[model samples]
Target: MSNNGDVFVIGGVEHMGHVGMMHGVDPNPHMSLYAAKASGMMGLTAEMLGKMHGITREAQDAFGVRSHRLAHQATVEGNFKDEIIPMQGYDENGFLKMYDFDETIRPETTLESLAALKPAFNPKG
Candidate 1:
């Protein structure tokens, strides 16, 4: 006999809810030090790590473009139809709408557009 089990994992982030504290909180001296030295923001930390790993900006931009392209292609081909369920959500204009597709997928995203954008965490980089 064999033991079997099924596991389902789901994770998401609501950036709007943390807009005010995007840099993170410094609740104590230790946290303050950590935040000051190693930026409490995940994006900033990732930037630092990428720099340390010698990952070039062009590489990151290319990766982002490729990701958007793949997602857009999948959406157009209805590849995610079975996995995605329609949900009630508010639009930017505050109107109630049924979101049946992945809203984050940007079909128009391109390498030039990504390259023109400044780094979100490190503007200098």
Candidate 2:
């Protein structure tokens, strides 16, 4: 996926942000150039960018929870399990062949727990 044609990046005044190569998947690349005019984010810290765009911390936290849920599902369901290779496990001395899927699933993804959990980002500040 190496291309030397051009590069296009896009961001919004809102919390939403996205970036992609111009020659790759983006059909209308000029829109990214247009968006950069108002974003003023040639390079900016997350907090700084948020402040510049009036992105509230509460709103960011809400979006973080939603992203966590989506990631939890994909990880637990082994959405990309087919990419895993079958490995061998040994008991005592003999070789035991086994296939491992996902080992990160907990049966506890309730909303109550999610609410109780602290913010998972920007912990230093």
Candidate 3:
């Protein structure tokens, strides 16, 4: 997951393409280098690195809150207007609508809300 490699996609019929990668997972444990030391999930790796660097949960939550605040502010200021392309997607009620803004951006996210989230990779942590 932490390999510095390049991926090439060979084109074919619509949506059908072959992806070639310089690095990937190996089935054999004895031949694998990072399989035992690192997790396949990036979140788990990030958590491990954070713990190694002495980054506390409170600090992480505060950072997440700050990031959400900045993203929300940028969206309100129309900073992403030129960057985002409006796409047609279905709503929760199956109504089709054009989405211009990032739907995943949670403007209401706060440190309290983030702190309430359990560790996704290691629950005990």
Candidate 4:
């Protein structure tokens, strides 16, 4: 038990070598969201498991809506400040800006809006 401020982190099976490096996929690229999907580690597995679990599209949409709502709520309640590092920079217009919150989340998201979204990777949809 020591408190020298050093932290050790371990990740599991999240590397290209773990998936055996399939076709069109990289042999040494870092494990990323796109890589995971291309490597059939998440895209196919998630779809199959989600269907097996009987999680309907509407349920997935509802969960996404809830996630965005909770994220927005956390931002408004100032809880986001604790989890993120502050960013201060200029936009494309060269105007200086200080970003302190998550601007991507929308608390006003609805089920209908989420339902409109289609699967991006799957072509059979």
* Cα misplacement distance, residue 107 of candidate 3 (Å): 1.3
TM-scores for all predictions: 0.70, 0.35, 0.68, 0.60
Global CA lDDT computed for model 2: 0.52
**Distance (Å) between predicted and true CA of 76, model 2?**
1.7
RMSD of each: 7.7, 13.7, 8.9, 10.5
**Best-fitting candidate, scored by lDDT:** 1
- Candidate 3 residue-wise lDDT, 1-125, digit = tens: 22334765543333212432223435465743645545533555677777777878888888778878898999999999997889999999999999999887898998889877877766766
| Clash pairs for candidate 1 | none
Off by over 4 Å in 3: 1-39
TM-score of 3: 0.68
* Candidate 1 Cα RMSD (Å): 7.7
lDDT of each: 0.76, 0.52, 0.72, 0.68
Off by over 4 Å in 1: 1-12, 21-39
Deviation from truth (RMSD, Å), model 2? 13.7
Per-residue CA lDDT of model 2 for 19-107, tens digit only, reads 53222333454855755533433333465556656766566656566756775687678775775566767646577857464343444
Candidate 4, which segments miss by more than 4 Å at Cα?
1-45, 90-94
lDDT of 4 by residue, 24-72 (tens): 5444545554554334545555565566667677877787899898988
In every candidate, how many clashes are there?
0, 0, 0, 0
Which of the predicted structures, 2 or 4, would earn the higher lDDT when compared with the native? Answer: 4
